[model samples]
Target: MTTHERSKAPAVDGAVLIIDLLASSAFPLTLSEICEKTGLPAASGHRIINALLEHQMVALNTSRKKSYCIGAKIFQVASTIYSKQSIIPFFYPIAEILKNEIHRPIFLSVPIGNTVVVVSKLESSLNATFNLHIGQTMPLHSSASGKAILSMFNAKEQLNYLAGQKKTSSHFSELLPKIKADLERAKRLGYAVSQGDIGQYVSCIAAPILNLRNEPIAAISTAVSNEFLTHQEARDFSKKLIQAARQLSSRIV
Candidate 1:
């Protein structure tokens, strides 16, 4: 890539370089070695490494003091991409069922790093429906589906994710506590709610699909226009959403 293009995409370029280097290597690399190989400055490599580590795309070998290697997330993604019928087939029908019941745009999503990616969606037919497409991603703190998945993360994972965010998030400390409270409430209610955080004039209700061990592997959500969402009605929809999520979780695990 040209210098100007690379400058415009520093984060993407640095991340791609680090992943390519680690994937091609037989052994883990030290922080200095990665910087040398990528020709990235020490500080630049450090920032890239922290971001990758938060996603579990790379893991630190603490025993070796700063050595890094591909983490389990790589394998998880590989299996999903390479394998046929990787959970989507089983989940979409459930999303359809929920949409028919709620008459809203239902979505299936999986948490990847600090965000959630839409894997499947059943679009609504209403004239004023909200829109969501498969493969779209949203930040964990901003979307209902994202927070539903985040509510299931352990304390350590949550801390690691928040700590790795880009430097532009100067007020993240002030924001994290509110997100934490939302997750805690979601955990108790078995669903999460978000108002226009991910979409303008849109409200969403989401619930986590749990694995056998009760960990959230993914989530299901319904996004609707704010005009249709009344206070009591939102809670009722949340309960129904949780019920649908639990049903899907059982079939998947």
Candidate 2:
């Protein structure tokens, strides 16, 4: 007789909730199916679906029982998120290669405002790597993947970002110089590192995956136990990571 446990986070808008449902679904859903799952009323859901269809954000499966799924517009937009053109289709190959070369957990992160969202992750089968999941967000200044992208920003952009970070936490303001220095060094080195920045027992090394405009849209990183990370490992992995980033940047649209 008990209802399902509820989340503490505030509820999202109905339109956004519908979009999220469609994104999470593996297959197209009928109007009723979407409404039932999202708890949206049939009338409101229909109106939202029609609007989405008009904008090419959702497409109806006319051949089927009027089921709906993501549209070409969403696909076009997704093609350029964290990973260029398409996150998985473009990044998975490189992720596999990095996994083979580095023997550690590889993660792909996209910047969503001040935080980075984990889009795709390849968990290491060796020695139990970091237990992170897809859709998890990490702070821009507190994680290696985040730093890799942050370092790609121009001087003005970097300063503005540091100012924002400093605003969020006065404690980090004292370390702003060192943080900026680290990003500057990473730009020159073509890779970034997080040594006990996110946690004491874990560490990461990352490189930014850029676009045709030379702006970073996402980052790729390998995670491992702090004890396992060494100077030699970082150097070797960094070289490979830079190469991978360059290759991906060139190949993406």
Candidate 3:
């Protein structure tokens, strides 16, 4: 079988099956419960659980009676995967150039698991302004980086990502329709914008970065203090932002 086919193979081992069931549960389960759910006998389940716990793949809740859950090791593995797959190494120099050219903060963000995380940032050299740094995460519905990335997803994926997050206000219910309209607009305009949505005093413009498969793997954005950009300045800065994003995208897969 091809590597892709091998990667897609279903789980066969008892421990893996138990882990899958635990992942889908959304809540912790006890050892007995895991065995019950997987229809495994007690001795077999105990052995699998012991092995998993030894590797820190499964964790026992010390405060509860035999309660178990997925462990921090899973998150550690996820972080490693994200770090290795990151494009920040390729994008940072471009971000530095954009920051120098625009005199504003330039940020590179990727949708990691369920959150859009800033992996790299070039802060404005100007004496005073909003400060955004690496490792910050923004609301998927409110930030330009989030919108630019969201524009790349299909309707179902976009809706799924937005589900369950608290809206900015009761009026924020209107945001989904607005976001849909914005996505359409972004597709035509080649970039996205956030006007004081993430921060009352800051505005941003962003464009998507696509991978080898033409899937948007991330976004690059430039944010300026609202006071620093007049209406005409904002428009001009957006053009520059779009140009920078296009250049950055070309460097990626």
Runs of candidate 2 with Cα error greater than 4 angstroms are 1-85
Task: Flag regions of model 1 displaced more than 4 Å.
Answer: 1-85, 127-129, 166-168
Clash totals in order: 0, 1, 0
Task: Give the 10-residue window scoring lowest on summed lDDT in candidate 3.
Answer: 1-10
| 102: Cα error in model 3, Å | 0.9
> What lDDT score is found at residue 37 in candidate 2?
93
How far off is model 3, as Cα RMSD?
Answer: 10.3
lDDT of 1 by residue, 9-68 (tens): 788898888887898798899989998888889999999899899999999976677799
Best by lDDT: 1
lDDT (tens digit, per residue) of candidate 3 on 28-114: 898788878887788888888888888898898776778888877877986886678557777777777777887877888888765
Report how far residue 215 has shifted in candidate 2, in Å.
Answer: 0.6
lDDT of 2 by residue, 119-233 (tens): 9888777758565678777888778888899999888988888888888676987888878888888889999998875567888899999999999988888876888778898
Query: Please, what is the whole-model Cα lDDT of each candidate in the order they appear?
Result: 0.82, 0.81, 0.75
